[model samples]
Target: MMAPATTSRPTSATAPSTFTSSCTRRTDGVTMCAWRDSGTRIVPTSSTSTRCRNPATPTRRTSRSVNSATRRSSRRGSPPRSIPCVRCRIRNRRKSPPGRSARTRSRCRRVLSARRCACGIDRIRSWLTRTRCCFMRRCWRSCSLVLIAFVLAACPTKTEGGGGDGSFEVQDPLTRRLMDPDATTDERIDRVLAEAKPGNTAALPALLRVMRHRSQAAFLVVSDGKARFGYRTVELRETQKDTRSMERVAAIVALEAINSPVALPDLVLALDDVNEVVQNHAARALVRLGNRAGIPTLIANLDNRILQRETANRLLEEISGKQGFIADAGWAERQKGLAAWQEWWAGIQASDERLPIEGRAYQIGADAEADRRIGFFVDVVGQYQFLFHEQARKALIRIGEPALPFLREGVERARKDDNATTRAGIAQILETIDHPNGRELLRDLLTDASGSVRARAAEAFGNLAGKGAIAALQGVLGDRDPGVPIAALDGLGRIGGADALAVIRRYVPGEDSALQEAHILATFAASRGREQRDRTLAMLLGVSIATRNAAHAVLVRITGDDAGYDSLATESARKEAMERYRGLLGG
Candidate 1:
């Protein structure tokens, strides 16, 4: 019945005991593990893979062949199963010793990727069907269930975090720790930095996962702020989320340090992040990557006071080879430079050109991105909404040189169709832009049949005033339109010096007339040189407070010195300030 007793290799007394438990072989000849009778543990099914102590030969997955094989094996009566020392191996594997997870994970990966599963469920099932052992057939159902329980209870599911994509499973321990949810922020960040090596682009998704999840409670601000004086002091009590999580920050830095070209888009999108640190880091990384696509955010950063504007400005200069970096320029002054950069970048995009990213030339051709931007803003230039109009006006100005032709065309159409409002709006923008190329354009606009356009053009010349515009301003003084002559006088006042001042004196109304203040302001604007200012200042020395205020305003505009005049101060106080100004003038 026992098929003749057999003896195998003798065991050492010093080693742990094994033969104390036994597995019986059925008359039909399939062997069972002793652990089943003794109830010992084996490797639990988790991310790690393991094996049965007495695994049977494996079978193919196709059910039909397995059934045919089973039928033939039953009739042939062949003995094909073996029983080795299963009890001791099962006892040893029941609980893994410490420091074994990484090795087990590695081994499991190899087994899952290159060989049959460790539990051999299919092999045992196939062995059960082929053998004529009645006792083994019953064991097959329970064994399959128990093996499945081991796997499901302890093994990683197909969609577990780090190795969800079997193809992208993380092998490096530090990388795996970086993605661990329960790890402290510092611990995670350290692990992320540890993997900052070349060819680690495989970990980019993990790095970016930390970047995009953005939920680290980066700081514990015990107090939001305590107001000690007029200002609230939050110096030591602010969250990094109020700034940006260092873990995420470290991840981004690691991405750049890793120097993978594929990180370009992540850097670009980070340019729009709410946190300034993220944007700054992203911008710097993108510049190093040699990608022109980062141009938009850099331009946007050009005006952000919190950003390194000078650095951004310098980068723009080097990247685009254009110069308009006015460090002290106000928003109004910056529009032209920013617009120029936009136009150049947009033109490149529209032309089906590649702005390299990640060491590859990725080209995008968006005809309408350039065209539609200029077109929409050009159409909105003279619209009714004040805010929208201002935005359109700025956008058009920022579109820079490319937008000029369209703006010129719009002005011409307005003039031809006698649309005074539209015509005047275009003239106003040209005045604000003061582009030298538009001076000729302004000269044509000053003669538009629309009186309102002529007035706006003359006013534009006042701001655009230089010696060359003197003749143009003087000619408009004789126009039949009353508003045009006043506007021309305003333009000449800012230019023509003594000669223009003499011309202006004729238009000054009688002291009692309503136009006196208008002429008075023009006289103030015309005084450029000391001689002219002396004559003008002498005239206004004893006039209305309003008149002195007008002269006071003009002096500050033409000359950077404030001249100590305070419009809000009493008249005698103003006189004292005026005396100081006249002394500075050496009048």
Candidate 2:
């Protein structure tokens, strides 16, 4: 048929005879050829044969088919192989034109498949090697975006209230609320006072800040038609009087509540406040804190015209064991009392022996000799270190009656040397002893030149609670020093006799509030039975509100009847209430 279709094969001697070429006639009337190796399998190959001119006629092997053939060839022990078709490989390198038909696309896929089989492992290896850098670049870009988002979330945003130099800001919420204009005066005062409870130390700094704060308004008119001064901005007016009072009161209450020696400095500063109540509270808080540093201020305030004068005098007497120099003296006579106090202060300062031992001059130990301990007690008492005074008193007390003789000798020696501190310490010890001789010794000190010495002596007499020194105590009732009279009244209360009652009654009608308070206390002690209470109730009529209030409190304690008295009520209301009580007592 057609002259037996002459065939052509590879002429090389290395080409095996088992390898064969197939030819297929296409509809276009052209022939195409494919080659198969006996050892490998069917593989596409470019041919120069004249009968194989139509490229489409030869069936191009797909990658799937090539892989199958490769697996079969490996099992048959064929060597590594590839399709020998250079033209097909060059065709795979060109991109297909746009808008190719489905059949054309199918043809392209087949060509690509055949090209993959021809290239085999070498094509895959080249692709991976070429794309390594680009793959890493794409992965890095994705990771960078995710990292940027995380960093933004972790950082804090800047705020207007943040510290300018990158320090942590201090914020007090209660203080901010207090400053709010919407807050009522009563609400603010109540909140500030609530912070004054014991153990609320965290509020201490804020309370101190509040104390130092000045209102931004100026020229406040108080409710009682008085002019009160303040600092205020031009925009602010009419600051509440109660608001300022509450702030000051809160500060004093906080100092007292904390009751710490560390608050002593602030309490001292508060003594200089313009408010008389603040100064009074500060002095009292200082005494409660057991800080003698406030003693000077209290002494200075004894001459103050404010209501705090009596309070300051009382605190000074309590702290220094000294009589207030001027109890009922006029302004001119008070100058002499102040001079006497200065003279005593100067005398103690000039005495080298009165100086307290500092550093290692004294050390207390359980193993120390009795003589050494006694010396330490003496030094501690003489020293101005009020903190150690209580401890020293305890040591002497522990020494018991055996130490009384030594203390008595010390008192005599101190008086000769004009050592007021030592004499005061001796007087305190003798008061604790309450011996018959101790009472007599205290009576002698009651007339000592130093007002402090006389005050301590009077205190000792009151503690003794015996009628032995009542005459000596009564003699000082007319003494110029305020503390002496007060102490005498207190001593007479403890002793309790007709003469003491008569002296206390004399002060009940007096105008001095301090003396009146002392008189009420003394009478309360001297009144022994129901008859005394009824008699004292009769005497309380028509007194000042302060005196009547004191008498009402005493009557309530003794008789368990408040007598319809209300301290906070108006003057007329209180008077009417007192009149009702008097009628009940048949006065």
Q: How does each model score on TM-score?
A: 0.39, 0.31
Worst 10 residues of 1 by lDDT: 228-237
Name the regions of candidate 2 deviating beyond 4 angstroms.
Answer: 1-369, 416-421, 502-513, 529-587
Total backbone clashes of model 1?
A: 9
Which residue pairs of candidate 2 clash?
216-232, 216-233, 217-232, 324-483, 327-482
Best by TM-score: 1
Candidate 2 Cα lDDT to native: 0.55
Scanning candidate 2 in windows of ten residues, the lowest lDDT window is: 227-236
Q: Write down the TM-score for model 1.
A: 0.39
- CA displacement after TM-score superposition, residue 289 of candidate 2 (Å): 34
lDDT of 1 by residue, 121-220 (tens): 6754554454444444556678889999998979755332342322223344544667675667677778878867876766775676556434321111
Question: How accurate locally, in lDDT, is each candidate?
Answer: 0.55, 0.55
